[model samples]
Target: MPSLELDRYLGTWYQLAAVPQFFNLVCARDTMATYALDPQGNVSVRNRCTTWMGTPNEISGTATVNDRVTGAQLHVSFPGVPTQESLEGPTNYIVTALGDDYSWALVTDPSRLSGFVLSRTPALNEAQWQQIRTAIEAAGQSQCMYLTSPTTGGLSGIAPLCTV
Candidate 1:
C-alpha cells in the first residue's frame, strides 16, 4: 500500500466514476467529496451531488486514520449510520492509488465492493483515466462495469467506457 500525505490529500475531489451505491443512486451529476483535516487530527468529509430531481444532496462524515505508518487505511463513519456495526470492519476505506501530484486517487473498501475514481477536476485526461482504470484492476475489483460517469461538463462529453 502507498502512504498518503494527509495535507496533500485534504481538499475537494470530484467523482469521475464510481461503483453505484444505494445512497448515491439519487445522484445524477456533479458528484464531489471534500476532506478537511480537523484540529484533532481526524478528517472531516463532506459529499455532495446533484440529485435526479435537480436538487443538491449532501452528507457529512468523519474519517480517522487507522494506521499512522501508512496513512492509507481509514475508518469512516457518517453520523447516525451504523458503519461500525456492519459486517465489514470500520477500517474498510483504503487509498489504493494516489497521483504523484495529488491530482487523482483511487479509493476502495476492504471487500472491494466499493470503489471511486476521484480527481481534482471534473474530468481526467486520457492518460490519467488509463492510469486510474489500471489501478482499479490492480486493486482486485471487477465491478468497474457498475461505475457511473458523472456529468460535470468537463471531459469533451466523452462517455464512460463502463456500462452502468
Candidate 2:
C-alpha cells in the first residue's frame, strides 16, 4: 500500500463486495463510491446505493489523506454523520491492495472491522475475483467477513469471498 498515487485512484469505484457497515445495512444492492479532487487538497467522496425498497440512498463526505508518505490511509467524515475527522486520530479507510492497472482495490481500516472490494466495472471475470480474494487474504482479512455486494449492473449472488 506504499506509494499510493491519489491521482490515479481518483474516480468512481463500484463496490463488488463488502463487510456490512451498520449505516449501510439499508442498502439492498448497487453500492457505489465516487471520488474527486477538491480544492482543499482533500478527496470528495460520494457514496450511493439502492435500498431494499428500491430507493436511492446517498451520502457525501470529505476524505483527508492521513498518511502523507503513502497516501493509502484516509480519514473520512460525512456532513452530519458522527465520526472522527481529525487527521491524527485514526484512518477509517486504507487502501490495503490495488490491481496492477488500478482497475480494482481492496480497502479496510486499521481495526479491520470492515472490508471492501472495489472495481472500476460493475462486474469482473473469475480471474479478477480470484485476485481480489488473494489480496484480501494477503491483507490479513477474513474472507468470511466479506460478502459479495449485489449490484444492478454487476454480480448479484450474495456469496462470500471464500466461495468466489
| TM-score per model over all chains | 0.88, 0.94
Model 2 poorest ten-residue lDDT run:
81-90
Model 1 misplaced regions, further than 4 Å:
84-89, 155-160
Full-model lDDT for every candidate = 0.79, 0.88
Query: Could you tally the backbone clashes for each prediction?
Result: 0, 0
- Poorly placed runs, candidate 2 (over 4 Å): 84-88
Candidate 2, residues 124-143: lDDT per residue as tens digits?
A: 88888888888888888888
Score candidate 2 by TM-score against the native.
0.94
**Per-residue lDDT for 10-56 in model 1, tens only?**
99998888777788888888889999988877888899988889999
What is the C-alpha RMSD, rounded to one decimal, of candidate 1?
2.9
